[model samples]
Target: MSTTAPRQATTPTSTGWSLGDIAVRRVDEIELPRQTGPWLLPDATKEVLDEASWLRPDFADADVPRLASHGFAVTAGGLRIVVDTGIGNGKTRANPAWHGLDTDFLARLAAAGFPPESVDLVITTHLHTDHVGWNTRLAGEDWVPTFSDARYLTSRTEWDHWAAADLDEARRQMFRDSVHPVRDAGQYDRVDVPEQGREVAPGVFLVPAPGHTPGQVAVELRGSDRRALITGDSIHHPVQLSHPHVHSCVDLDPAQAVRTRARLLDTLADTDTLLLGTHFPRPTAGTVRRENGRYRLLAEHGSEIAATAA
Candidate 1:
């Protein structure tokens, strides 16, 4: 048995893994406040989390599941892609933790060798506030596309759903600042993602993963030797692997979310596919294993950059 202790949290740096020809890095934004777990995943009570002993200290701090907001920068087939931009710096968000903050996200991205200007594509797994916040940044008086040279890609179904929904003031503000700017600049490209999935770039495909939102899709990366799936919000934490039915508080369709998660886990279990979670904390990437008829992650640690002064 491997007796490896969970990796401790350190200052955000250029941490990543290499999948044959594909190189992926986790660019740190900010670790969410401790309150996020209970609020976002109310069903994952302390008792439930305690059951997954492996989750302690790393993925979860005792009973509270630990989560961080970050982006995965991928270099594949000569394309520099960013998967799900985290909450951007200086944004007015309804959630207090996400509102009007400052972080060195861009600098971290550059450290990972993915500067904004050099980014070829921005893959938005869904149109949620957090996922798209970095889609644009405040430029003088107006929000502008952060990745000036990149094309923003998201599922056509995701864009259409938000287009028709009666959004709250905060959500509208998110769209106005983060989403619309990219579209207005002709940088947003909506792709039709069928049930089987759609390839947006070489070795990069968008797999249908709905229910958290109407058209949430998981990004799939296939390398010469390994395949990895980026779970947008479908699997918020490793605890969910132990409790597949545990649903998010904001899931648009909780039942469908469960179905989606179950199917995804079933397919991933005992397979070599690496699961890179969008919100997972340190040691963010892992492999899914069947445990007692449920699932659990066997974390895959990658190379890390030394923590620098903030």
Candidate 2:
């Protein structure tokens, strides 16, 4: 494996982390407060937020908890791999916040040195609206694959579930525009990974982490002596690190989500594995620590062994 020097923590901004020679960066789309009622963790009321004092200002405020929609760019093994394309421009979404998003997401990706055509692989951890929106972009009159030279990878089970799901017209439109276009272009690859994990690239693999979505998987990167996991909605906020049972409102199976969260946390606790949360706000990358029989996210602050940059 290739080797890289360690860097410092710089969050909110476009931060990048390195595992050996593999570089992972976050491309921002939008970061805003989401309602706690029927949106985030329904049980995460003022009382719960107050109890989790560490979530203040960054992840949550006095009112509601906040989450971000962004894409992660991983460069390794002579390939530029992007995970979870955030909400794209000019799309009709069921949620008003996500509708017709005309953000500088593409420009930001280019600024990070990975343009659309430069991408080699695009992986959507699950078929969520926010996760797959940028899979395609609006052309003169039709949606086309945004990464013209890349192969888009979607979980086989996720594709089948969303295709047959009893979704409304708005969600169906999502599949038609963002998903089908790539498949039609023969630029799509369906991945069926085992629970133990499936290696997709030189030092990268997919770890089965279901229940947030039935086929949700976490992307794992391993170097010679360092490791990290890109948690794709499996644990939405850091509060879930303290309270793994707090399921998000968007979870397809709340009970199963809790189990998966607990299992993932347990497996990573006290290990060297760096935890990179997809929706986590500033200082998004961290490590899990078992504290007093509970798990806590130890945010990277230029002190941890792992290095992050933008």
Clashing pairs in 2: 16-309
lDDT (Cα, 0-100) at 1 in candidate 2: 9
lDDT of each: 0.88, 0.80
Error of 2 at 310 (Å): 17
Off by over 4 Å in 1: 1-12, 305-310
Over 1-310, each residue of candidate 2 has an lDDT whose tens digit, in order, gives 0122112122333467767777788787776435423266677767777776777776777856667777888877888889999778899876766777777888778767778988889988998888899999989999999999998887788778877789888888898999999999999998998878898888989988899888889999886668899999898888888778888877999999999999999989999888988888767778898887778777873222222222
Q: Write the per-residue lDDT of candidate 1 for residues 230-295, one digit (tens) a residue.
A: 999999989999998988988999999999999999999999999999999888989999988779
Task: Name model 2 segments beyond 4 Å from true.
Answer: 1-13, 34-38, 301-310
Model 2 vs. true fold: TM: 0.90
Q: How far is candidate 1 from the true structure (C-alpha RMSD, Å)?
A: 5.4
